[model samples]
Target: MNQSFINTAVLLTAYDPPGPLNCVFFMLTFFLYVFTILANLILILVIYMDSSLHKPMYIFLLNLAVNGLIGCSAVCPNVMDNLLRDAQSISYGGCLLQVLFINVYASSAYAILAVMAYDRYVSICKPLQYHTIVTPSRVKLLLTVVYLIPVTLLSFQVYLTSQLPLCRFVINKLFCDNLSVVKLSCVKSALGDLYGVFIIASLVVLPFFLVLLSYIKILHVSLRASKESQKKALSTCAPHFIVFINFSVSILFSVVYNRHSTVSKYVNHLISAQFIFFPPLLHPLVYGIRTKEIRRSITKIIQRGILAGPL
Candidate 1:
């Protein structure tokens, strides 16, 4: 099992039909890609330039927007291109890069969200110590860890996948995914798939559960506070909830669909689209619409052309 086998391996046995569905998919996904890029970019710009948004929560949101941009970029362009050309072929190297970027972006976003949950916990659960615990230096350190850990983990994942002998590089979804690539391996892929499962469990499921628990505790504390304080807490956490739901649903659907191909192809396609497009498109909107500071900042930027320096 080596590169030679990969060269001769028939990874994709069938060609995807260029039907009305594919054309519709192409148009829809192309529109989504444009919207995702524009929305996330606007959020990033607003966060960076808004003086009022110079807080930990907004910073976390900026991080999320950045991650969403990277994630969408990793998948959407290639998907749009393939859809337009009726091409489903992906080279082994290209597939590996896509997997690596997807993992980096998705895992980093999860890490940042976990940090945000902790931030909210400290603010709501330990208000007296919130400032001390979540200082600018500590926030910077946490963000660094959020990004670095994902890069390290994804590097190892890509290295491991590269070592495997690819039989065919045809990924079923619009983009290259880790599981799909592993399924194409000529050799036994149990180890690689097992590692992938571990990565998903640790990076995705465990953190999400912890975030949910933290929010539950935060909500309990918030309910006991004054009405003004409760409103403020909800305002801060609302955007995070929106982002969490969007990402979680997409990931859950993708994982479930990966387990069974006998299911309808259209169902898988829908899940894949959700996983690829929804986060990037909605993340910015969630934060922008839910956070007044962000909305004001965006308006100020549009009107004044320059208000504050970069973040």
Candidate 2:
């Protein structure tokens, strides 16, 4: 074909060209995505099915699992499909929807973690007042905010980002990351960057600080307790600590690397995967293995299933 004809044909193709190591990357990511979904789903199911788990902490965890599911759903299928297929291009509207959900999921996850931290704080620091402070009504209110705040923030972000003119249609990462998409715009507005930073600070940074503060107070309270109480406090806070460390490290590395090196695209991608996928994958294992309650609940459920089966 002539050069012009070839170029036209390429443009007419629905997807972008696959990367050189597409097969390997796709398989690895697909496995991790499956693991993440299954782990989070199992945890959610376990929490919901067990009447004993219908408490404040588990409720927050269930919320976290739901958010993780939404996040994985938003990014993984498209990424897996792109990796498997020759066509990698996403429609403009589809890209925007991906961006919106990713933001919403991320923000919701943070908010839920914050709620979990507050639950721990109330339980530990105000033992007598815990029931009144962290009631069912309060949990509902917190969950409502967690779900609504992200939707509001991302709506504004998507609206602003969609207005910017695109110089290039190629997005480097697997999914439509807000930063990567914004960087592609021909007109990079300070307003957009500021808004992005504001959202990051409020959603990610602020929650991190609050979690830290809550844990510090929790530690102090635990120190004053008897040995048994101290152990229980530590156990309750342990999963949150792991989550906080994983999330904070990922976010910190991403922010620092993005600021320092223009060629840190690959590093940013790794950080993104760690941020979204690792937590859900590891959360169940961490909590399940460490907490007797979760382990016992799972065992009981399995035992009941076996007893009820035809075989």
Candidate 1 residue lDDT tens string, 81-135: 6665645666677677788998898888888889988898898899899899999
Error of 1 at 58 (Å): 1.3
Q: What tens-digit string does per-residue lDDT give for candidate 2 at 1-311?
A: 11221122111122236766767777877898999888888999999999999999999988888888888788778777876676666766677778899889877877888889999999999989999899999989999988888799888988888777766666656677677667666887899889988998888788878888898899888888899999888888887888767766765665566456555555556664566667767766787787788899999999999999977
Off by over 4 Å in 2: 1-20, 258-268
- Model 1 residue-pair collision total: 1
* TM-score for each predicted model, relative to the true structure: 0.88, 0.88
lDDT for 281 in candidate 1 is 88
Worst 10 residues of 1 by lDDT: 6-15
